[model samples]
Target: MQLLLIASEVFPFSRTGGLADVMAALPESLVRLGVDVTVLSPWWQSLHGQPTEVWRGSVPHGGRLQPGAVRVGEVRAAGVRYLFLGTPDFERPGLYAEDDVERFLRWGNLVLPTLQSMGLTFDLVHGHDWAAGTVVAHARAAGLRSVYTIHNLQYQGRWNFAEGAAWSGLPAAMLPDAEFYGDLNLMKAGLVFSDHVTTVSPTYAREITTREYGEGLEGVLQARDAAGALTGILNGLDLDRWNPAADPDVLPMTARSGKPANVAALRAEFLLDDAPILSAVSRLVSQKGLDLLVEALPDVTRDWNVVVLGSGDPLLEAALKGWAQHPRVRYVSGMNEALAHRLYAGSDAFCMPSRFEPCGLSQMISMRYGTLPVVRETGGLVDSVPSDVGFRFSGGGAGDLSAALHAARLAWDDRPGWQARVARGMALDFSWEASARRYVDVYRQVLGA
Candidate 1:
């Protein structure tokens, strides 16, 4: 089967968050399942390596044709083709621009025509998040099968109705679904027009049908679910990139043996004493429940050594930096791939207290490195980490997190039980192969093939 996957970001080439990782791995996994897949994404300034121009074209915008170019590239790891839409509007420093809705509308307008120019045909056009939501609408309008995946509902790409209508170049007759409460909501277009809608995890899929997690689109999603057009598929990890056995940075430790050397190395590097180490690798944002962690830090630092890696939200960064002065706590300001691997390998437990996580890769990566995860019982964290493998708390509050952390510490003190838990976590499989097979089934269901 032929497939076209569209997203705003892709890993290794360009990335800002989990969406990039998902786009990078999923297409390759589909290719391994014998599906011919092509990816479409923007040409961000951070994008490494050059892609040769495959086709040049113009998209209709504001009653005029806007010039654009299509550059073809290959992901060597997945053996899948990727095409980048290059326009001056997209040549920015960040993955998202202030005029993201306008930029992506231009991108969506060009997708089908660009494929036609390249003489490429696909059985399905899959759009990821709001950035590519209009692409799904375009595919559906053309009477082609389309799937839309909502990575996060919070970012719906809403704009002023008048401004959107002026810039989008969409037909007048198709305005209802695109407009919500005098604003243009791109996410609504996908949920309303696509053949199918999917989220990263089953829990998240169900959660979005309600007002609490829906971010103002619950009613639309509920209607789609009633129509049998919604699905919840758990995400899979890039096993090759996160494998502990093969990762050069990780200390050589089998499932049977413990990672003492790595633990010692981490303690020495951070100037920490012989205390149970708790680590977190996440962007410091409220969505990640960092506030809860901050509230519980006083009690947490009294017991365990804490290390944090990642940067976001200047206010939260400042708060965490202040806490860094605490003797048992250390904070690194940005993402370091090598350090992340080592930290995962060395830590006794990994913390993820997300208020609403769709499908987190960090908990999975932590497990793969033989570090048990202590997470809030929400979304993918609930699905991936079982009672035997890790600790989970229910309420999204400081007390709840503190209790879970205490339990983890108790588990840590039980050397035999902790080893058993670590072994179970490491033995669990979260590879992309299983996830790809499930996606193949979704495709077949959509095509009736």
Candidate 2:
């Protein structure tokens, strides 16, 4: 089956969060399952290499026609075809444009026509997040099967309805479904108009249908769930990218021998003594429950060496900075792929105390690296890590997290048990093959095959 996957960013080409990784891996997995896949993404300036021009077209914007170009590229790692949409609006430095509404509106308007211009036909078009929601809407309106995946509900693209309607070039008749109160919601458009809606995990799928986690779209999500059009498929990890034994960046180690040399290297790197290490690699935002970490720093650092790598939110940065001054604590405020691999390989425990995690890849990566994960019991965290394999806390508070960390530290003291837990986690499969098969099933169901 031919499939078109649309997203704002894709890994190794452009990326900001987990969405890029998902888009990168899922398509490749689908290809391996004998499905023909094509990806559609914006041509961000930061993207490496240039794509060959495939199709040229125009889109409506601000009352006039604006010229648009489509360039075809290939992800060498996945051997999948990807098309880049290029226009003056997409030549910006960052992945997201300052005028996101207008930028994605133009993108949504141009996607279907661009596909037609290239004489490409697909059995299904799957869109990721609010950025590609409008594109899914357009595809569905044109009588094509469409799927929309909500990576994160918190980032719904909402804009003034009147202005959005004008800029989006969507008819006034469709405004009611697209509008939430007085604002135009791109996410709502996707949720309301798409043939099916999916989230990253089953728990998250159920969570978003309620007011607590719905971000004001609970009614819509509940309606979708009632109609049996909502699904919660757990996200998968790219084993090739995350395997500890094969990763060149990480120090050579096996599950049997343990990562002593790497642990020593990490201790030296962080200027810490030989203490049990707890590491975190995540955005320093409230959503990630960094504030809880900050609050529990005093208790956590008293027992274990702490290392954190990430950047986001000024207040959280400041809190992490303060904690970094501690002799047993080290903080690196940016993205580093190599260092991340090293941390995963060397650390005794990994922390992901997210207030709500759709499907956390870090915990999965940590598990693959034979490191125990200490996470809050929410969304995918609860599904991915069993109690015997990792530690989990329930309440979204620092106290609860501190208790869980203490439990992990106690587990660390039991060398045999801890190693057994690590072995179990490593042995568990978080591969994309199963996920790909499920996706194919979804495609078949949508097409009535």
Candidate number achieving the greatest TM-score relative to the actual structure? 2
**Poorest 10 consecutive residues by lDDT, candidate 1:** 59-68
lDDT of each residue in 1-449, candidate 2, tens digit only: 99999999988788888999998899999999999899989877778777766666653332354543444444445568988877667776777756887778876877777667667888899999999878877776788998889999999888888888876766667778999989989999999988889999889999999888999999999999999999999999988888777789987667776577878888888888778999999988878997888899989987799999999898888888887889988889999999999899889999999999988899999998888999999999988999999999999889999999999999899999998998899889999998888878888888889
Task: Give the lDDT of residue 106 in candidate 1.
Answer: 70
Query: Which regions of candidate 1 deviate over 4 angstroms?
Result: 59-77
lDDT of 1: 0.85
What shift in Å separates residue 285 of candidate 2 from its native position after superposition?
1.2
lDDT of each: 0.85, 0.86
**Residue 400 local lDDT, model 1:** 95
What's the TM-score of every candidate structure? 0.96, 0.96
Residue 4 error, candidate 2, Å: 0.5
